[model samples]
Target: MTASTANDQRFREFKMPDVGEGLTEAEILKWYVQPGDTVTDGQVVCEVETAKAAVELPIPYDGVVHELNFGEGVTVDVGTVIISVDTDPGAGPVAPAAAPAAEAPAAPAAPEEDEEPQGRQAVLVGYGAAPSSTKRRPRRQQPGVPAQPAALQAELNGHAAPAAAPAPAAPVAAPAPAPASVASAPAAGRPLAKPPVRKLAKDLGIDLATVAPTGPEGIITREDVYAAAAPAPAPAVAVPAAVAPAPVPAVVSADRERRVPVKGVRKATAQAMVASAFTAPHVTEFITVDVTRTMKLVQELKQDPDMAGLRVNPLLLVAKAFLIAIRRHPDVNAAWDEANQEIVYKDYINLGIAAATPRGLIVPNIKDAGTKTLPQLATELAELVSTAREGKTSPAAMSGGTVTITNVGVFGVDTGTPILVCRRVLLRHPW
Candidate 1:
């Protein structure tokens, strides 16, 4: 075969796999391997942030990196082609693939018009099931109204709109257009503001239609909503000569404020916390305990050869005591099944240790923690903390916990009412 033909046959596309259970998308945090780099089977090529955690994805086969389909920080849907590789680069000089007329991220080939769409495609990792479809549902337009293009709709909705068509290669050399006069009001229809901004305006009892949009493409921003909500300045009265005008305070510029978009582990944590707060009835009981003997025992364990190199901290002792209490009272280590209207008691304990990391708060559990010895627990705890701190904790490590313990004393806080995880009891330890 010719070099071009051989290269075409050797190219393999790698799709984004579902790293977390039932997760539909993930943001590309970092790419470890760039185009033209070599890769081996099971070699980590990139790191992605899912709703559950930050996970490293490994390539499934050995190859020379052909292309990177998406850039970092882009949130791509599962099953989209993320990278391509030339498995047999030694065959000959690889021919550059022709770019399509439409400029967009690489995606899986669509089925023929006559061919029926298949179910979920096989994923890159472990041959798991990928998403059945990545196409979005069509938006409903009002009667007698013409349908707007996707990019225009996105712009109207106060989102960063994508280009409607590919731009010219030398577009930057083109002459700039004159700036248009700002509109006093939005065009006829719903006011253009993001969902969060709309919520804020509603909460502040302000009408969005009355708020002048200072954002690009006539989109309303939070500042616009706030300005609209501000009470009208009192009509100034004719002041007497003796009455001195009040000094004006220094005005802080809005540019100083920073807004971070909620996503990934932090977003998931917030949703889970809100759901937990409303769904579960929480009751906290505080008690004083003398831990002088416990501290001495911890020190003694640190000196023991069996516990050498193992973490022997007060938290370990607290976890041991909590496990023992659960052993005595098994009813406390159970979850309520609201659907079945029953209390499901667990036969084994998966003890979760809540650790706060740079990404967010994650509760990774040690499987069958109740059955492990003190030394084993210490070893696992140390490894867990290390893994979590490095942002390498897998989704499996954070799931299926029967009970959880969070050490509030680590932050020097006396106590806190921690929300329950997975509807299981959470014990907060404080020094």
Candidate 2:
């Protein structure tokens, strides 16, 4: 259906473009169009979420949307064909696809948990999308058709005119711009939020597309989102509908929680955390070093003629201090290999610092912290901070930590017991 009829009217299927500006890819959150629906170039077709934001995909061709390749929540590479548009290359092409109806059904009660996945028919990748609506909306005007509302038809062209005098000299043809098309193209329905807010949502992996728009012109503003956060225990009320339901609402608990099944990065984090917590008999000691001493060293280093532009920071000192402390407490940094039945004490300090991410807490250690110069450590620290904050930290950078010093002092309220993995014995999988 997306095929263009004119030989020269080539159909250009717009894959999900990287609208995030130099960002890599996005998750295909949902598609608005299916086969047989009309679409116009520049119309929004699907919604995608990246590591940094959620965005709407504008259809690139004026045609029938032939297929939707990806379903909700399946992340596809940028430039991937999530939808194909069919069109006639001629000046007057077919009308664009109509807007989709609400994706949710009107059910008062939640369905049983185990059955939800089995009931939903996923798109190509089997990524789950919101439930489909059984009902359809009324048809709207199509391309090459009038955009005028149906009610205005009684006073339309020629109905009130006299047919005499050669039909009144066949009223002189006047030129006017064609009416604007209705977007309704299988809408991914991301409420409008500007690029920066979108970026924030993407960074948080928040689905702005479904959040209620409280801003003017039905846009989802950043403030709206912040309010939506904070108290996260509540499942959002189903999006408002035209035929409003008349039931009294129940106030649910304000607990921030979601029971995600153990898998992927989370599963790995759990195993690693548990291992680090119990295996090593974690004896976390805290000494709030008036990091004043380290802070003074940083200032001195910054002013040094040789260290100009080295971008000195307190973390550099912490790394140095950790290495210094390691000389005395090398025992704190060793790992036990259960299978080999050996105590693995690493001589080289692969000093690892841990940070929190949208995925989970990740501990990426500095490679050979013992060998790098002050400048090198500063550079590595900057690179690591930037990459980890951007959620692009590599896995290899995370493993094989001899010992680690976590800067909880940076959190302002310092001093706490830290847990290290306890390896009960060489035989029991490093509990």
> Candidate 2 lDDT, tens digit per residue, 1-431?
43333422444566777664454666776677787788876888876655433456687578776567777767678777777665653445544555568788666565554344444554665365544432334455444554453334424521344333432333434556555334322236646788988887777667886577777666678887776654658776886687777889776665655666544345556776786665555443333346567678888999987677667877677677667776677665666677898887767788766666665666677888887877888888878777777766654566555666555555665355555533421110000
Pairs that collide, model 1 = none
Q: Name the lDDT of candidate 2.
A: 0.62
Candidate 2 residue 263 Cα shift, in angstroms, is 5.3
Q: For model 1, state the Cα shift of residue 50 in Å.
A: 1.7
lDDT of each: 0.85, 0.62
* Clash count for each candidate, listed in order shown: 0, 27
Q: Give the poorly placed runs of model 1, Cα more than 4 Å off.
A: 1-9, 90-253, 426-431
CA displacement after TM-score superposition, residue 351 of candidate 2 (Å): 1.1
Q: Give candidate 1's TM-score.
A: 0.62
> Could you report the Cα RMSD, in angstroms, for every candidate shown?
21.9, 29.0
| Cα distance off (Å), candidate 2, residue 428 | 26
Stretches of candidate 2 off by over 4 Å are 1-264, 288-291, 327-331, 421-431
